[model samples]
Target: MPNLTEPKLISGNANRTLAKAVARRMSMHRGMSVGLVDARVERFNDQEIFVEVFENVRGEDMFIIQPTSNPANDNLMELLIISDALRRSSAARITAVIPYFGYARQDRRTKARTPITAKLVANMIAEAGIERILTMDLHAAQIQGFFDIPVDNLYASPIFSLDIMHNFRSQMDNLMIVSPDVGGVARARELAQRIGAPLAIVDKRREKPGEIAEMTVIGDVTGKTCIIVDDICDTAGTLCKAAEVLIGAGATEVHSYITHGVLSGPAVGRIQNSVMKSLVITDSIEATDAVKATSNIRIVPTAPMFAQAILNIWNGTSVSSLFDHETLTPIYEGMYSAA
Candidate 1:
């Protein structure tokens, strides 16, 4: 821990509930204080952004809590302005604590003359005087290399693995971990290994973004309960289609475990009509109204894990242990309530 005495926690409008949760977790220990700036960000008639931070925080160890989720442009600009304010006010060190790092999918330029927006976001953060970054479950692992500052890219797999072990333990023999796409095979494999289940993959060809033309099942899903795993679920296109494919392939049940639920467009409706029995998502990003209304969707909190990571980082301890399987068993156990 880096002298918790002088650290001042501040939050923007991105995810106040998560920020408060993190603050409460930090407050569990003595001698640390937290604050929030009146960061009311609004745009002019011409679409220009204006940000104002109402608190003064000079020469303090500042942590700005903001997630670049939906309305990414506004949230991102708010974060940048807050960072600039802290820097101008002479904060000793500034850390951008983003539970969900957006624009992560744009890590590479697949087409000619296209932009790598992920690197651009990193540049903006660095330019805003962010000394460090704390984020979770980046869409692409390579995005971490885009940042010059110390970037801690956390994983939500441990959180999900624990939840599955507790709720689906009795059905362990029938369970199969599925990668919704070939790109996420490693993530699916990790979860499969943790729960001692078989692994499968969904081979799909994309004619365009958010559209899956066709899917082929790579492994046996017949008469088995399948759990589709992925880094993020945007439109829920792949998940719904994959679930349908699994069901058609003799799967008895279909469920999804995704790290980030960037549920945009018709995702909620898609999941509602799909064959999926349930869709489990972590609260890396706040749940939208549509998500709340969808009966098939469930949300698990990541506050405990994130808070533990923050504690370990501040204490100058090993973060590797946080990623270890043994350390995460409790998270899933907690998911199962007392009967």
Candidate 2:
């Protein structure tokens, strides 16, 4: 039997801010003494990750909110070690709430002599004693199959659609959702259909990673407000180039709403100099000062959304309602007050 009825959240160094936010959300509920598990994740002088669980977690459900974002290696290690400690301490179940799963891009090998790192990471997590996984907007949906445990991969469409409705309340008729590439059409199409907007595609050729050799627009974007939607934006090369293509095709302006902003290298500079009106990303990845300083880059808070999902999962309620735009208003709008 489980030690506790409610779940306890544990955070890692990868994104402590987000973990804190999740804790805060849980603290607001009534009859729910949900709070962070008393634990600490520190390091040795040799840069080794160490974790210690202070409080009794024996038979308690544990949720670790750690996104394997930048410095992914260290964060991944932290998660594995924390799970190991919890397992040893006799936690009932451990669910990894990794919003931005690192190495997800390496779900498969495009060339010979390359390893499928995503599969390997999944294996490592399973081996570390995690019972399940909860994540959002995985780069590839198929990555869920890599895990033998139950994986509840959430969608950001609910959050993204709400934001779009709020920001473009009046311009809904003129908006056109665009997939930066063919691979992202399904994601973009979901938003387009919800808001009753047209769909467009950016046909681009990638010779190698971080470089888009040639590009063209496949649908009519003329006189429309083009909004590019994608899962991951690492180098921002593809994002910036796709925005430029939309403008050349007579788009009124270009905007983007990517799930994970893994903005690396000159990504910030590229987005700033590009003709894009704005780039809206979720709080899945903590924004640095450069990202926060940009006038055109906006961050949508996912704390409320994630908090709701956590609540549902803990109660064994249906989280499927969170996948729809029409069904998830009160949660995102802060309807659940202090209880």
Candidate 3:
């Protein structure tokens, strides 16, 4: 049997900073000398991935923290290789802690002969012998159904809610939560309900990938500070255009709270020139140098939440309770104080 009480954590090259932060928080919360396992992920001259685990993992509960972000193929392959290595070493109960699930946008085939890459990725992970999965704020909730293993999909809403309350408490009455598209109305509505604000939607027509043809506001955002919410911001074309439409409709200020900041291509440039007041994103994907240099871009740490979730899973506690902000606020505050 595996030692379920003391879980071993291993991280790949993907999002090392976030992984370290999560490990630190786990050590603080559990009051143990929890640390990341020693590992080396290297590549050959021909671009073949090689992963070596230094410590013995036999009969230990193993968790690999690797988000499939930039260089998605490389990071994902690294994760699979690491899992196979751990499984071959007789590690018990392997869980892949993927903070940001890449290729999640292709949950279904919208066009003829298109492939559902999300489902394919799920199958790949399962075939690699991973017994459990832990991810946050998937592009579509339905993607969870693709996985056969036990998956604990965590949410970023609680963290965003706390930050909004702390920073925008005085402006709550005049605040309006806006969804960048109809698909995201549910997410925006939940956040709006938490802050006691009205919800608005940006009705947009996508002519093709990475391009927005038309955009119109569904509800009144006139003279109110609008906060656009969404799961991912890749290339940022839609978010920037939505901010323009909101500003034109008399919104006092426009801000965005996105879960994954896949700021590829000209995303940073667009945000720099857009009417948006600020763009707040979680540390699900590691930020690039351009993102760091952008004046209006801010990153909220997600380590505390991931830390708590890992602890809960190890202790066999209720994971859903972490979604309730009212219940988890004190716990987070305590963790901060301990740090």
Regions of candidate 1 where Cα sits further than 4 Å from its true position: 1-6, 29-49, 54-56, 329-339
lDDT of 3 by residue, 1-339 (tens): 433459889999999999899999888887887899999999999999999999999988888999999899999999999999999999977999999999999899998999999999999999999999999999999999999988899888888888887778779889999999999999999999887899999999988987789999999999999999999999999999999999999999999999999999989999999999999999999899889999999998989888888877777788898889766687568433211
- Report the number of the highest-TM-score candidate: 3
Write model 2 residue lDDT over 139-165, tens digit each, in one string.
998999999998888888777888887
TM-score per prediction, in order, is 0.92, 0.95, 0.97
Q: lDDT winner among the candidates?
A: 3
TM-score ranking, best first: 3, 2, 1
Q: Which ten residues in a row have the lowest lDDT in candidate 3?
A: 330-339
| Model 3 lDDT at residue 275 | 93
Worst 10 residues of 2 by lDDT: 330-339
Each candidate: how many clashes?
5, 1, 0
Query: Could you give candidate 1's per-residue lDDT for residues 113-143 as a string of tens digits?
Result: 9999999999999999998888888888888
